[model samples]
Target: MDQRWEDAVFLHWRIPVPAAAARMPPGVRPDVVDGSAWVGLVGFRMHRIRLGAAVPLPWLGSFPEINVRLYSREPDGTRGVVFLSLDAPRLAVVLGARAAGLPYVWSQCRAVGPGRSDPGVGYDVRRRGGRTTSAFAVRPDPTVRADDELSVELTARFGLHSRFAGRTVHVPVSHEAWTLHPATVTHVVDGLVAAAGIDVEGPPASVLYSSGVRTRIGRPRTVRGT
Candidate 1:
């Protein structure tokens, strides 16, 4: 699969290792750094989705998305993301991803902008016929680059670990390093984290923003066992 991820707002909270590890698949564990594990609530626009060598689905493929995710690492230190939930507005995309074990929820989602009233970029997500929702915005400071260790660790992941047909599968992805800027939270109202079964107090520990990246996700392969 190939697609473009644009105008991403990355909000992350640090959590105990145990709390994150408990959510990992059997053979994978929480990826810990800076003495803790981190969970991210990321919002962005998904554009130009295309199957291998196929034309991009311009309309059906483009939509706003927000995902709650945790980091995972195998015994041999293969790092990846483990999504707890993905909120997208398109029902067709939701159904297709769920069939492959991605926890995609159909929702009313949209991307907001750096307009006159609100000079920050953000996203909004609300579950279909329900109350679960999340809204957040960030002001990226272009003067400073987000090239620190923790930033790279969170944004430069190359794959994901997921469950499919009772087995844990690893799907690799290829993408150039993201161009990130340190950011500050401008506004936020969230419930997606709670819906994802994670609890954290106060505001996000780290906030960053990026214009976007083009990604290519590879085929899934089973882990060594289970």
Candidate 2:
């Protein structure tokens, strides 16, 4: 599958390694840096979701999405993300992703801003059940630089660990190196993390933004330990 993510804002919080490890599935442990692990709440607008060489379908091709993610590492040094929940406005996408063992949920979402060329953007997500919700606005610095240690640590993930058909699996992903801008969280109100059983206090440890990335996600392979 091929997809483009645009006007993305990444909000990451430093949490105890054990706090993140306790939620990971079998075969993967928390991928910690400096004795701490990170969890991220990322929001973006998806575009050009295409299958094979097919043209991008209208509604299916575009939507707003938010995901709750954690860092993880396998025994052999492979690093990846573990998604706790993916909230999207498209029901078909929600259903399809869940069929593949992703924790996708139907939600009402909106993404607005001056656009990619602008320095700020806002996102809002409210799950269908109305129990889970998130809202935030980001304003990125004008200067763009290659990611620093903390930025790279959070965004350079190459794969994801998930359960499919009752088996732990890894799905590889590839994308161009991200050029990030330091950003500020202008405002925030969230329950997405708590909904995932993660406890985060105060504000995020890091806030970053990028125009976005074109990503290609590979097929899943069963984990060796599973």
Candidate 3:
């Protein structure tokens, strides 16, 4: 699959390892950073989704998405993301991803702004079947470099860890190094994180933004002996 993620906002919080671990699927464990595991709330617009290298599917190819996710690694040190829930506007996308054993939920979602300034973006998400919702505004610093150690660790993920057919699978994805910017959360009303079963008591530990990147997700490979 090929797609582009635009005007992304990343909100991260450092939580106890147990809080993060409790939500992971089998065959992977929470990846600790600075003695705690981090969970992220990411919102963006997914654009031009195509199968393999095929033409983008109309309507189905573009939408707004917000996900609650965490970092993980296989026993062999392969790092990836473990999504607790992905809330998207398209039911087709929700169903398609769920069929593959990913946690995708249909939602009412929108990404607005970049407003008069390139960095001020707004996001809103509300799950269809439940009351999970989120709204936030951010100001991104275009000059911040993404090469810093923490930034690299957070944004350079190479794959996703999913639970499929009673097995844990790893789906590889490739994208150019993100050009990230420092961001400040100007406003927020979130429940998506708590809905994912992780308790974030205070403010986010890290807030970052990106102009975004084009990406390709490859086939899945089993990581657990199913």
Question: How close is each model in CA RMSD to the real structure?
Answer: 1.3, 1.7, 1.5
C-alpha lDDT (0 to 100) for residue 93 of candidate 2? 91
Q: List the residue pairs that clash in candidate 1.
A: none
Which one is best on lDDT? 1
Shift in Å, residue 32, candidate 2: 0.3
> What lDDT does model 2 reach?
0.88
Report lDDT (Cα) of residue 158, candidate 2.
84
Provide the overall lDDT of each model, using Cα atoms, as 2-decimal numbers: 0.92, 0.88, 0.87
List ranges where model 2 is wrong by over 4 Å.
53-55, 115-118
Expressed as tens digits, the lDDT of each residue in 99-206 for candidate 1 is 999999989998998677755899988797767878899988878999999898888899999999999999999999999999999888999999999998899999
Off by over 4 Å in 1: 116-118
Alpha-carbon runs more than 4 Å astray in model 3: none
> Candidates ranked by lDDT, best first?
1, 2, 3
Count of backbone collisions within predicted model 3: 0
The digit string of per-residue lDDT tens for model 3 on 1-226 reads 8999998899988998988888777888999987779999999999988888887787686788999999998999998999999998888888989999988988899887887646588689877765778998798877766567787788789899998888999999999998888888989899998887888878887888888899999999999654
lDDT, residue 219, candidate 1: 96
What is the full ranking by TM-score, best candidate first?
1, 3, 2
The 10 consecutive residues of candidate 3 with the worst lDDT sum are: 113-122
